[model samples]
Target: MSKDTDNSNLTADNSANTTSSPSNDRSANNVAPNEVTFALAQSHFLVGDISANADKMRQLAIQARDQGADVIVFPELALLGYPPQDLLLRPSLSGRIKSALSALSDIQDIVMIVGYPHVDHHGTFNSAAILHNGHQKGFYHKQFLPNYGVFDERRYFDKGRNQVLFDYKGITIGLLICEDLWEKSPIADLKQQGVDIIVSLNASPFETGKQDMRKTMLTQRSREHKVPIVYVNAVGGQDDLVFDGGSIVAQADGSIAHEAPRFLDQLMLATLNVDSNTFNTQEKAPLTLSRESEMYQALVVGLRDYVNHSGFGGVLVGLSGGIDSALTLCIAVDALGADKVYAVMMPYEFTSKISLEDAQAQARRLNVSYTVCPIFDAVEGIRHTLAPLFNKSPADTTEENIQARARGVILMALSNKFGHLVITTGNKSELAVGYSTLYGDMAGGFDVLKDVYKSQVYNLASYRNRLEDTPVIPERVITRPPSAELRPDQKDQDSLPDYEVLDGILTLYIDEDMGYQAIVDKGFDADMVAKTIKMVDNSEYKRRQSPIGTKISQRAFGRERRYPLVNKWSINS
Candidate 1:
């Protein structure tokens, strides 16, 4: 759904045509239900890694059982990973998933609630299986399938209709999916019908302090509906998204009993005593990570999982010893260990020897593998190759691009031969103004700092290096004019405005979605704004091919950011 679409009224009546078996009720009465503890198991999963994911589920189930959990709750799409866009179209994979579900059901001694794609006569469904009493007792289809901003859920699954309550060990627990809890009607309707608790399975992506927002919303909902809520979310990275599995429980009186940390995967066992006693909450919410720390961890985990899950042995970066490449290398080293990172200094005619020296020094300080591969010969060869086409005319921007492309191609060849992934160092500000070349500087399997702006890139680089504290990036590298070193005397300021001014205009137009005239009204140069917008508008095709990056802003280039390639629309409108 778009940001504007709200469908809270999609609640369906689950009034019983037939009641629970009297024998079942008798069985429930005979069993003395004390403090019942259930485990919310968060798994780190890779997309389409079926057997590995099932093995993970089986292990979590066994561990939860050992920890005295009556039921183990997994996240949405735990079977195949979340947002399995085109993978759902494979019929054999769907069959394998169903077989895997059956295999999981065969495990004894624990009830498992697993999210997966279900194939039915009507179509495929985003569903969770209610496994108990030696059989699949019930199934719930996700109703509010999101279809916006990296979620194309509507493209695959069918919506559910009924809301049924399951009686397990004498507790009436209502089942809902991720987006279902976002809608108030389902939980409210269940509470009106006298449900005890809501068990929601989710794969919600991490976006800064989304956990705090979830806590606030669920706490208010618990107060609004007079029912406790247990939220279980998936943990890991899939392409651009990183799920911070912060499984939490909120009591009806607006108190949170248990809260898990963000980023790390865990199996949390929460015990809730439900009875005819007065409706009053007794537990306090656990202290979650502060907002700054939360965003920091999100970036760390995002880079970590992106490296590990993509099957890259290490990372190869063309380091210019500038703040951008320095920060990118620091993050890569931190994420994939210094031993796994291979840095190459690809200096051209404009490159200063200070850049090469500082980069080598910083690599030594970090204990990373460093190499120097000057591109002057390759530049001449490329100029030689294209000379016949250009009739040996004066070299232009095309020649500069040839140099960048030579570096990119060499990095990619290293990536191919050695199983290392090339990390692109261009930040969002450079990408926004078409300062980075396509198939040249932008050719990489992933971008570590693509969402960050240029000025913020310098700050983060400085923070990571800690010259005042420990020094990860060399001081000389930080103290230099920003340059791509494409020509004999080239600098970033020559092609674009100062980063301070450029980042400000891009923020207003890109993040806030402001129009051209509105940006001009903010006292920015009209000609600069027009030029920046034109560059941004022309770079749509390049952005489309760029690897997915973690979303740090309201509008990131990977998923939340969408644009038309063949368009003449100007922001003046």
Candidate 2:
């Protein structure tokens, strides 16, 4: 942590911003004593699109300059996009990145602080540089490399180790990348150098309640260093991760002067008073959302960015009139719009008339392109072929799985022919217990509801309906018991515990990492707990094969939580 200063030395105000006379020694650093306006570029960047990202940065830089901004700060890895993964290994993108950086120099007048992977003979570093009047002013490499949970910077980037401080106009400003601000040494370095403000560029991914944590951390950093901090974060989804842009500008007193909106791409402006070493942030209150609404927006933003960035014409969701598919469909429509979304109801023999009617009714309600592709013949054809092998035994889950496979095949065929991204609808509950048929309902380019549990699916569906003037999801779909409808009278509860109980047990077992007996100790039936754990344990192989989805929780199926698929350890034993 940086050294702290007494509050009595600071001027505090609740209005727009505050200003205070600098100390005698600090007054020497003020050259001209003029205020500098900084534009925080909380923009979206496509992963690995060097040219596009550069073009966007140039446009934003020009816009910032035209708006009379003295400086503009972009998020970390904004040029090549954040967490480029193995794409960084491509020798081809290096030249493009250098070219893009050169092109960015075309914009003059305003100072630009940009983040990118600085590659050279020394190897790649998570880095940021200050540019002024088409020349590099100062540069800093990130001091910390986060390796845990969704972050693997150690695999791709070498740790950065030096402090970058420069005199801009009259104020001495320092630069820090994402993880650098979270650590102590970097801020301490800047404090010792007597920098007035710290401008941090970040590509921090979103998790439940992550913004609150960021605010607390930024406050701590500001208070410790006795320096104001300008935090700029990227917005948009890159694969499973979504960056919720909540850029902030806070004073040494730990009070925010500006806070940008989350899940949105916009430029936020703040003016730093050179003499006072304080600035007025944008005067809008941060938008607050409930936990459910936050998770819902995460799913929507992740899906929308994934589809648009991938160049998909639209999305295709198999609407089975079940809660999982119903919720998936609603999210797709909301994300990509009804015009871009195509819904198909693949009904088989076991599919009830209510399902048939409800699917069509909901499609009509949402007014998306809806089609019915009966899979009875396709499932029968498969059943006939497998009849010889299964003739010795009574029909089991294999038969039920064939119907799901048939529906999956049809959805995929449409996806292939029409160029629509297929969206899988299975929830975390089904995915956890191996209830989903591999390559059947699991076949899709993306899974919107993959991180969402079954109980949350129902709640999100109800929440979606409330967001609309009229209900998009049929009431019966919400009220009716959930069923796969692959077999006659097939209810999910027939195989698994009621979702209320199943989800609770799962939260403890999977999320909380409780032992078998410990979960049972949480008031669940011992047998159910044992059985559920076994199902979850045995289904690792299936989850490993499932499509990647938006991660709304701290412990999602992919990336966040990793378990060996071939493990034999049993909690019950």
Candidate 3:
């Protein structure tokens, strides 16, 4: 049967409705006689793996039911996975979804609230399926379709117009998808409908300081509506996006009952007292992480999932002994084991002794495979080939770019030969101003710090060093003045502004979306702001070709921020 053919009609097939008896050793009975147990399945569902995702849900449902849960909730789009993108438009989507739902309908006793794509003659929808025993009980289509940064739900789904509420064991439960709870009207309507508890499914991607925002919103909404809330979120990385699973259970009075650990898969359970209309607090809540800790974990999870899901056997990093490469190496080791990571330092004539020492030291400290491949021969050969074309022209940035391209060539060659993923080490500041050489330093499959600024790179390096008894990244690397080592005594500031001033300008212009004059009005030098904006606008083509990386900030370069490659608009205009 089609999953949504009977959207408004809920009926059970007699043969398929056979349910196993409830376990006598029920964990919920020990809590309270008038309470119900909810299991939050915060899991990683790979995109396009409909059958596998359905099997995972079935496993979690049986486990939750055995542990005495009356109901289980999965994150938004659990079956097809969140941000399924163009996969939702595939012709076979309906058949796959139907088969997956049929597999899930076999679970007995407990009700399964699963997120998926609902399709019928009307349209496709971001929806939730209510499954109990062998019946497709009912479904809730997501009301709000977000079309802002990093989201284009409206492109794939038609908006749902009704509130979906159901009763089980004498308690009224209302359902909502990710964007629904963000708007006020949905929850207000639920409150008007007298819903005792609200269960929201989310595939919300992670950004810096996003968890705190979620907590504040949940607290206010639960307290305002006088209804308890159970929020279940997906965990893992999907390309540039990382979904930090910090699922929560908030009481009607705005107190936290349970908070799942961030960036990890968890099957968390909570009990709600029907008499008092409150949830029971757990003995220990997960500790809130510092800013550095949160960003660091998000990066780790992002790279880990991207590499593993992309079917890479391992990763290769072109270590330059600089802060960016140092931190990228550490993250790679943490995400993939030391055994799977390989670090290669491609040095040249101007490569500093300190850089060589630091690069070797970090690789040894991390216990990863390390190699020092000097590019002197390769660079000289390239210069010889280009000498005839130049015909005695004075050398410029072209020579420096040759060295970077040599390193890029070596890394890509190694990756191609060994079936490993090449990780580029350029940071956001470098990418913003075209400081990097395209097909040179930017030739890798992934750039770990593509969204991270130079100042943040230093901060993260220091933060990572503190995690160990002996620093994994060398202290000299962090404290030293940043350089490309492309030429003798070369420093980054020779080409670009100081990172502190540049990042401040970037934060205002890019993240805060401030105009050029408005940024200068905020105590910045007008000349500096103008220069920074010009560089940013000119470098759009480079960023377009750059590899996808982890996005830990509010605005990342790729899908989150888009600009015309040949736009005439500028500060003067």
Candidate 4:
């Protein structure tokens, strides 16, 4: 949260004089004489590439100037990328930032509000620099540093004590960063400063229903302040987080003037009328996406960026013909092309004939490189190796786990040999209750559905199938009962609760953070609630070893939810 600092008592370092002289200003600012054209640069910036990021800003600035823009806005920390984590602690961070800012100083005419880290003798600050006419006009340090789930801004940046506002082409624009807009004090203070408009830069990550919440907040803030707002967000995948660029523009009357598409890069423009304090309505605004579409695209962008940025030739998915791997294959083909994707059906003695047929059918439909690598030899070799130690004990889950491990070894071997990443297909339901093996089915560099629940996997499969004339995933894959095919006549429900009941309890306990009694009070059986909670608590070690995936829910298993591997506190207690 930001403090309510007096505008008159603002320090010298925070505010700057950005008004240009009549002789030096460009005609773009004088086009309407009373209006200002803003270019929102909603772009994907690669992390740790300060030099290339700065070059991109320079190029975008020139393009904005050519399109008759008075000012151009980049997302928060566009120079260094978002969630830079410990890279902010690098000794050369200050030097790199300084060099990048110097590189953009030559751009002319258009005002560039670029987000970068400002390292001074005082401390490092998440700041936006206003560059115009070969001079650093002024800079605004982000006042609110969010330190909640997935955000650790306070770990690296100092609190900004002063408010920053400046004038450009008859418009008094107040500057705020991502978290600043979410707070009440920043926008309220800007309103008190007679600011005509608010331009907020963001690196907001994607999650289900996040855009609607943002739009609601924007409408409320703009109406209250009687000021138009321009929002620009960064778009791309960085590790586990996906930034969906759904930049927005809201009029003073609380109506949406423009909205950029989600999960894509966009350079959007809008003109603000100084008299009415509203933007001119464009011919079209992008339609909002359905829940399934949003989640699916987030997965695609997350996987696409991770594989490509990590220098992998392509990706390999173990196609089990179950819904999990079936949905995974469709996503892989969409993210990377059919040529870059390869599917291997690792069938064992227990695997069904229907599974084998459907696996081959889907691969043919998608036109990807598919292989049927029977794991009979691999599993038998492992069993023979361990049989000497066992004194003719009864067969159990141990043997079943061997089948999964055999497949894991084969996939990792192919990945190591060909330099392609192995993408796991485990869903959140199995991951929640520790149903997956540690290094067996979980062996992979990335898990596309790691954050998605099993029920949602079916929804996404149906959504993907509906997009084409012919479904890429076979109908039998979705209709069949899910199984690991590690044991004979296996169905997931044999060991766990039905997905309907299981996801309900899991959503309450994990996502909602409800207690055991509270979840049981929601009509779930008491014993089932206790059992599910115990499994989730006991599986922290497995989740810790799990690969990163796209975050599509309110709370993902990674950084968003942290639990001790061995804790004495019980849900019942």
Which residue pairs in model 4 clash with each other? Answer: none
- The residue-by-residue lDDT of candidate 3 on 310-343, one tens digit each, is 9999999998999999999999999999999999
Clashes of each: 1, 1, 0, 0
Give the C-alpha miss distance for residue 560 in model 3, angstroms.
0.6
Writing each residue's lDDT as its tens digit, candidate 4 over 1-573 gives 122232211211254333333215564544676777899999999999999999999888899889888789999999999989889999999999998999888898778899999988879999998777677767999999998788899999998877777766556788999899999999999889778789999999999999999999999999988889999999999999999999999998889999999988888889988767779987988977999999999999999999999999999999988889989988998998999999999988888899999999999999999999999998898888889988788999999998888889999999999999999999999999999998899999999999999999999999999999999889988897888877778889999999989999999988999999888889999999999989899999999999999898989999899988777999857
Regions more than 4 Å wrong, model 3: 1-33
Give each model a TM-score.
Answer: 0.89, 0.92, 0.95, 0.96
Q: Give the candidate number with the greatest lDDT.
A: 3
Q: Which 10 consecutive positions of candidate 3 have the poorest summed lDDT?
A: 12-21
Q: Estimate the TM-score for candidate 1.
A: 0.89
TM-score of 3: 0.95
**Which residue window of length 10 is worst by lDDT in model 1?**
1-10
What's the residue-level lDDT of 517 in candidate 4? 88
Ranking by lDDT: 3, 4, 2, 1
